[model samples]
Target: MTPPEPLRDVIARHGLQASKALGQNFILDRQLLARIAAIPGEIAGDTIYEVGPGPGGLTRALLDRGARVVAVERDPRFLPALAELGAEYPGMLEVIHADAMRIDEPALAGRGARVVSNLPYNVGTALLLRWLTADWPPWWQSLTLMFQKEVADRIVAPPGGGKFGRLSVLAQWRSHPSVAMQLSRSAFVPPPKVASSVVHIVPGNAPKDVAARSIEQVTEAAFGQRRKMLRSSLKSVPAALAALEPLGIDPQRRAETLAVADFVALARELG
Candidate 1:
C-alpha cells in the first residue's frame, strides 16, 4: 500500500493558505484533527458531511476512520489539494466546492449521515441553528461541530446562567449537546482571535406536539428583552402573555429564569 501524502506537503504543493474573509483558520495539527474526528464515535461506514474542509486536515481523519466523507469547501485555492485527497481515498471522499449556507445539507446527505465540521467562524452559529430547528428528527444522525468557546458555552449551558438565553433554550429543547473538546488558538495555522471548542450533539425527542419554530419564536421574544420581565418582553408575540397564566408561569419572571421545559410549554401554548 502506498503511504498517504502528508497534509503539509499537500498544502505546500497547492500553495494553500487560510482566508480571513471566509473565516478560515486551517487546523494543521494532526492530533487535534484526530481528536475532533473521534467525537462522532463509531462512524465506520457512515457518511459524514464536512463544511469548510480547507486543505483536508479533519477530512483526512474522517476518511481514515472508515467513514465516507462529503466535504464542502468554498475556497478555490484548496480544491486541488482536497481533490488530491479524494484520489488518495478513492470513493471514500467527495469534495464539493460551494458555500455551505446555501446548500440543502439534508438533501445532499440523504438519511443516516452525520454532520462533522470545523466550521468557519462567520457562519458557525447560523449553521448550528439551522440544523437544530430542521424538521425532526433531523436528517443527520448527529452533529459534531467546532465553534467559538463562547458560542459553545451557550449551546451546552443549562438554565439560569447569563449564557442561557435563546440559543441555550433552542439547542437543549431539541437535542442533547455537550462540549466534547476545547481547542486552543495555537491549534490552527493562523490562530483565531477567540478560543474554540467542539460540540457533540445528538437529536433528542422534541416536546410532544410542540413545533421547533414556535420554540424559536417564543425564545426570541422572551430573550429579545432579556432584562425585562416576560410580560414586557413577550408582549410583541400575540397570545404569549395569555398563555403564561394557563401554564402557571410567572409573568414577572425574566427569560433567564425559565427552564427548558417552561420554554417548551410556552411554545406549545403559542401554537
Candidate 2:
C-alpha cells in the first residue's frame, strides 16, 4: 500500500491555515509529535482524550502509537481534514466538534483515560486548573500537555521561585509533574512568539483528610496577595490563617516561600 500523504501535504491540499483566534499553531513535524506521544509512556490500546487537535497532527501521532483517541476540536475549519484522518484510522479516531472547556471530560472520555494534547494557548491554564481540581483520583490516568514555556515552568516550579504560585502548589500537591520536552518557537507553521514545553503529570497520593477545595481556597488566598506575608494574605481565609499558627508555619513568610507540603498541611488542618 502507498504511504499516506504527509501532514504538510494534507494541510496544503486542504488550504488549512492555523487560526489565530483559536490559538492554533500547526506542527507538521511527525517526529516531534511522536516524541510528544511517547512522553506518556506505553499506550497501546489505551484511550487518549485530546483537545484542540487542529488539522489532526498530534491526533495522528497518538493513533500511530496504537492509542484510541477521542479528539475535541472547536474549529470547524479543520474537521474535514480530521474526518479524513478518522477514515484512515477507522474506529481508532473519534472526533467531537465542541469547545473543550464545556465538555464534561469524565463523562465523554470515561474514567482512567489518558489526556494528551497540544492545548490551545488561550485556554490551556484554565483547563489544567479544572483537571487539577477534579475529584480525588481524577478520571484521567495521566496528563501530557503542551504549554508555553512560562506556564510549563509554573506547573513544575519549586518553592522560593518567582514562578512558584497557586499553579505550582495545586499541580504538585496531588501529582508528579515534569517538563517532558521543549520545542523551539520555529517548530510550528506560524511559529508562536514564545517557546513551548510538554508537561507530563501522573496522579500522586493526595493528602488524606484534606479536601481539594481547602487547598484551592488556601492557595487562592495566599497567592492572591503573594507579595504580602501569609498572615496578611490569608486573612480572607480565616480558617487557613487560624490553622497556620497551630501548624507552626511562620505568619511572616510569603506565599512563595512555603512548600507544597505546607499548603497541604494547612488544608488538612482546615478540615
Candidate 3:
C-alpha cells in the first residue's frame, strides 16, 4: 500500500490555509496530535467526535489510534482534503460538512461517544457551555477540548481567584475538569496570538434535586455583578438573595469568593 501523504504535503497539494474568520489554526505535528488524541485515554475502539478538523491534522491522529471519528467541518474549502482522508481511513472516518453549532451532536454521535476537538476559538466557550448544560449525565463519555489558555484557566480555576466565575462553577459543580496539556503558539500552521491548553473533563456527582438552569440563573446574577457583595448582586434574583440568609451564607461575600458547592447550594435553595 502507498504511504499516506504528509499533512504539510496535503495542505500544499490542496492550497489550504487557515482562515482567520473561521478561527482556524491547523496543528500539523503528528506527535502533538497523538498526545491530544490520548487525552481522553484508551480510545482504540471508541467513537470520537471532532470539530473544525482543518486539513484533517488531528483527525489523522485519531484514526491512526484506531478511533472511529465523526468530524464536523463547516468550511467547504477543506472538504476535499477531508474526503481524501476519509477514503484513506475507509470505514473509520465519517466527515460531516455542517455548522457544528446547528447540528444535533448527541443524536449524531450517539450516547457515550467521547468528544475530542481542537475547537474553533470563536465558538469555544459557547460550545463548552452547551455541552456542560445538556441533559444530566451528558451524552458524551468525556470532553477533551482545546481552548485559549485564558479560557482554559477559567474552566479549572478555583474559588477566590479572579479567573473563577460562572464557567468555573458550571464546569466543576458536576464534573472533574483539568488542564491536560499546554501548547505554545508556534504549534499551529499559522500561529494564533495566544497560547492554547487542552482541558479534559469527565462527569462527576452532580447535586440531586438541583436544576442546571437554576445554577445558571444564580451564577448569572452573581457574576453579572461580581464586584458587588452577594447581597447586592443577587438582589436581581430575589430567590437567590433570600436563600443566602437562610442557607447561612454571608450576604456580604462577593461572587468570586463563593465555591462551586456554594453555587449549587444557592441553586438548590432557589428550587
Query: Which residue runs of candidate 1 sit more than 4 Å off their true CA positions?
Result: 1-3
lDDT by candidate, in order shown: 0.89, 0.93, 0.93
Off by over 4 Å in 3: 1-3
* Per-residue C-alpha lDDT of model 2 across residues 148-204, encoded as one tens digit per residue: 999999999999989999999999998999999999999998999999999999999
Model 3 is weakest, by summed lDDT over 10 consecutive residues, at: 1-10
Residue-level error in angstroms, candidate 2, position 18: 1.2
Measured with C-alpha atoms, the lDDT of residue 180 in candidate 3 is 98
Model 2 segments more than 4 A misplaced: none
Give one digit per residue, the lDDT tens place, for model 3 in 5-26.
7899999999989889989898
- Predictions: Cα RMSD each: 1.2, 1.0, 1.0
